[model samples]
Every structure is written in structure tokens, then in C-alpha cells.
Target: MFYFSVSMREVAFIKQNKEKWLNFEKTIYNNQFKNPDELSSLYIHLMNDLAYAQTYYPKSKTISYLNQLASAAFQRIYRTKREKTNRFISFWKTEVPLIVYQFRRYVLYSFLIFGLFVTIGAVSAAYDDSFVRLILGDGYVNTTLENIEKGDPVAIYKSGSNWGSFIGITLNNLYVGLLSFIYGVFGGFGTGYILMHNGIMVGAFQYFFHDQGVLWESVRGIWIHGAMEIFAIVIEGAAGLLLGASILFPKTYSRMASFKMGLKNGIKILISTFPFTFAAGFLEGFVTRYSNIMPNWLSVGIILITLSMISFYYLIYPHIVHRKLKTHVSTL
Candidate 1:
């Protein structure tokens, strides 16, 4: 029988192909390839060499080297294919949810801050009837008063065309969300200010309805959309706080690196709010106008569903995913 040591064959093969393999690596690393097609051609040749090594010397270092080279080339050749895949799907399905889970403390803080400010507004309005006018402005209060007399305190929502209202409101809401997120650059003060401002407005607005003996009615109507709208704002506020926390406390990472990570995660969290914002705007523009006419059960149902969806996706689902990921890593 013929006797040929694997090492002897491997040395001969490497001696023959070393230059070509090195050139291929250099071309890839230097970005000298003209296009993906040329890169793919090199990758095919490398794979053939890798296959030969695997067959002849499965447990040899040559096999390992060839396998690694082939893998790298394969990744390079199909890099664009991965990029061209459905980014939107990956973002929503994994990225955003992971971020939410990772930074849940910020979300809780935002909620507490917002709730405190709301209490301040409500207590102030309760003590002084003029507080509503002070917070909401005279014209708005007067118009709302007139609407109350007309038995439609929320009539203002019905004035605009549905589609126009949808577009305008959605844009405005998105802008506010952007503001809440970008303001994180100011060490989160700007974000906190925005949350407090919105919270006060909400508390005062609800109290205004209460003064007119329509607090329950107002809840049924406004909360149908407000549930999503306000919840998203809270989430956005959390993103801002996350940015601030990164800058304030970088921990092990360099400040710049931490800031960059924070910004990236914050943006992911911010993007996740868009669907909720759009849904809220649609509800306010179309469904809110009919609040006076819609059955109480339907309004309540919408509010519950919207709130439940937000809570489940942002709060519950994130924890579940994080736990599963931790388990997976532990097993690995």
C-alpha cells in the first residue's frame, strides 16, 4: 500500500498554494476587489482548496487554516446579501426589544418622574380653578368651557378633516418624540423637562374635564388614544434618560464609546415608538372625534387593548426575551 503522511501532503499543498491564499487575503483586506463578483470568484477557489484539505487531512492544522479562510471569504462574498435582508424585521423582532429589556430601569424612572409631575398639576388645579387656565392657556380653557356647555367638551378634536388631522397630528407627535430623545444630550434635563411639561398638561386637561363633571366621560374618550400616545412619550423619555446615563456613568467603557452605545440604543428605542405614535394619531384624528357617539364599551375596549399591547411588548415581552437569552448563553 502506498504510505503518504498527511503532514507531508499538507506541506506540499501549502507550498503550492500559500502565495495564492495570501494574495486572496491581501486583496480582500485591502478592498482591492472590483466588486462582489470578483470576490466571489476568489471565494469559490478558496472553498475548493478548503474541501480538498478537509477530505485529505480532516484533523490537520491545514484544514483549520483553510476552513477559516473559506469562512472569511464566504462572509465577504455574501456580506451584501445579509445587509439586503429585512432590516425592519430584525430591528423590531430583536434589536428594539432587547434594548427595552436592557434599559428597563430608565423606563421606570421616566414613569415615576412623569407621574410626579402629573400629581403636581392635578393638586394645583384642585386647589385653584384658575390653574387650568394658567396651564392650558385662556383661549383653550374658554373654548373647552363653551364645548362643555354644548355637551361636547372634546369637540375640538372633530374640527379637522380626518386625513389632514392624521398627518398633522402624527407629524407633531413624532416631532415631540424626537425632541424628547434628542434632548438627552443635555444630560437628560431637557428630556425630563419635556416629560414634566406633558405630564402637567395631561393632569390639567383631565382636571378641567373633572371640574365640568365629565371626568369619567373624558377618561373614556381621551384615554382611548392617550393610552398609546402617553405611553410612547414615556418610553421616549426613557431613551433620553438612557443617553444621559451613558454619558454620566460610562462605567468600564470610555465615555465616547459609552455615549455611542447609548445613542445607538436610544435611537433603537426611539424608532420602536413610531408605530405607537402613528396608531395614537390615527385614533385621535378619526376615532376620538366620534368619542361622544361611540359606545362606552367600545372606547373602554380600545383603551384596554392599546394599553395592554404597549405594556406586553415593552414591559413583559422584553423580560421574557432577556431571560431566554440568558438561559441560551448559560447553556452555551
Candidate 2:
């Protein structure tokens, strides 16, 4: 009879706090912590409740419920602590890489569009001498020709102090990347336009070098940094496409919800390009200037390594990470 009464009292206690406990769980999982202090207070209150239940209702279902809630709260707290401590490490290791894996199809599509534009530019330049001059602009073409005559076709890369050029180029590239991403709000057409424009410019630029009979020389110089720079632009385009795609095909999610998720995810992918963009700019400013002096093999080697690193991180590492994460979850 005493045991029955004890069980009844435990049941009554659970009935009183069950809603609050469930609400806490909902808030924790949903990441609705606008006021972390409030959450901390609630956590303390929950711990106290768990202690009471453990002392009086040890073997009861009420005690079990409290224990689980406490455990969840603890886990959440521990996770939050880790996230704060390892914010940068977590971002590269998990956040950005996962986002890249999730939106790979967009990346491929962006790459195809860019490649098509490059081909168009190259073909146009090949068939029409006027086409290179037109696309590249008269002043730029004339200046490059003058430099070529001076036996310094790639002299433009030596224009500024290494650090000065690095800062300027990095900022410009970042701005371009940001614009490419921001334009996705227009249903991705803007991003495609940017990609097409840049692709044509690259093709025209390369063709001009070829027309001047400096194709190989220009490549050895420009590609030392162009590999990463160009690759980052393509990735940025992919991010924009993701934004446009979410709105066009929300699937089961509401349009707003889909847009929010896309925006969040797109930003992550864009951020992942920053380090590469900076590296490219650094190489362009400090190293590309000496392209004429560097050994052909050394220049080619740098370009190859840059391409490999970008390819592996954006294209290959994501797959490895996704598979590993999936396996980890399956084990759980």
C-alpha cells in the first residue's frame, strides 16, 4: 500500500512537469535559444528536478523520465561548449564540407555553363582577329601588344608591390564572388550571366595571348594562380544556383522555408571559397610577377598542385566526409 502511494505521488509530480520537460526538448533540438541565460536557468531547474526524482522515486518511470531529460540537456550543453571552443575547426571539418556535398549538382551545372562560354570565346577569337580585339578592348589589346614587342607580354602582373597587389586583388575577387552569390535571389539567371561574362573574358584573354604567340608563356604565368581563382568563381556560381533552385523547386518544404535553408547553405559554400581565393590572390601578387623568371617546370608544378588541392577539397573530400558521417550515423 505504501509503495502504491509512492507511485501515485511520483505520477502526480511527472504530470506537473511533463509539459515543461517536453518544451525544453523541443527548444533544444530546434535551436531556439535566443536567450542562453534563460536556457541555463532552465537547465539548472531541470537538474534539481532530476535530483529530487532520483532521491524519492529511484526505480519509478518518473525517475526514468527525469533522467533522460537531464541527460539530453547535458548533452546539449556539452555540444554547445564544444561548438564554441572549436568553432573554426568544426566549420572546415564538418559545416562547409557537408554543405558542399549537399549541393554538388549545382556546382556541375555551373561548371558546364562556364566551360561552354569559354569555348565560345576561344572559337570566336580563333576565327576572327577582330573578335579578340573587340572582346579584350582596344586599349588593353594595344598595351599588351606593346608589352609583347618589349618582350614582356606578361609585364602587367608586375604592376604593384606584392602585398599591395595581394590586398587589392583579394578584395576585388571577394567582391565579385559576393556579387555572384547575392544575385541568386533573381532565380539564378544573374549568376549564369556573371559566369558567362567571366568565361568569355578568360577565353578572350587567353586567345589574345595565343594571337600574340605567347600562349604557352601566358599560361605558365597566369595559371599559377588562375586555377584556384577560376575554380572559386565556379563554386560561387554554384552557390547562387542553389538559392535560385530552392525557390523554383521547394519540394515538400514551404517556399520560405526552402529559401531560408538554401540561403543558409549557399552562404556556407561561398565561405568555403575564401581561403582559396586569398591564396590565389597571394600567388598572383607575389609569385606570378616572376613568371618570366621561374622555370617552366616549377610554374606548371604550382598550377598543378593548386588545381589538385581545390579539386580534392571541393569535389573529393566532401564525398569522403559524407560517407564517413553516414557510416557513423548508421552505427549509432
RMSD per prediction, one decimal? 13.1, 12.5
TM-score of each: 0.74, 0.75
What is the lDDT of every predicted structure here?
A: 0.82, 0.82
Best by TM-score: 2
Instruction: Return the clash pairs for model 2, or none.
Output: none
Q: State the lDDT of candidate 1 residue by residue for 1-332, as single tens digits.
A: 01224577677888888888878867754677877767766776787798898788888766655654554453344333344448677577655776787688899999999999998899889998889989999998898888988998788888889999999999999999999999998889999999999999988888889878989878988898899999999999999999988899765346886799789889989999999999999999889989999888899999999999998989998877656543433332
Per-residue lDDT value at 90 in model 1:
59
Off by over 4 Å in 1: 1-85
lDDT per residue, candidate 2, 15-97, as tens digits?
A: 77777877776666577666545566667777778888888878765555555455444434434543554777877876677
Model 1 per-residue lDDT at 328: 38
lDDT of 1 at 245: 88
TM-score of 1: 0.74
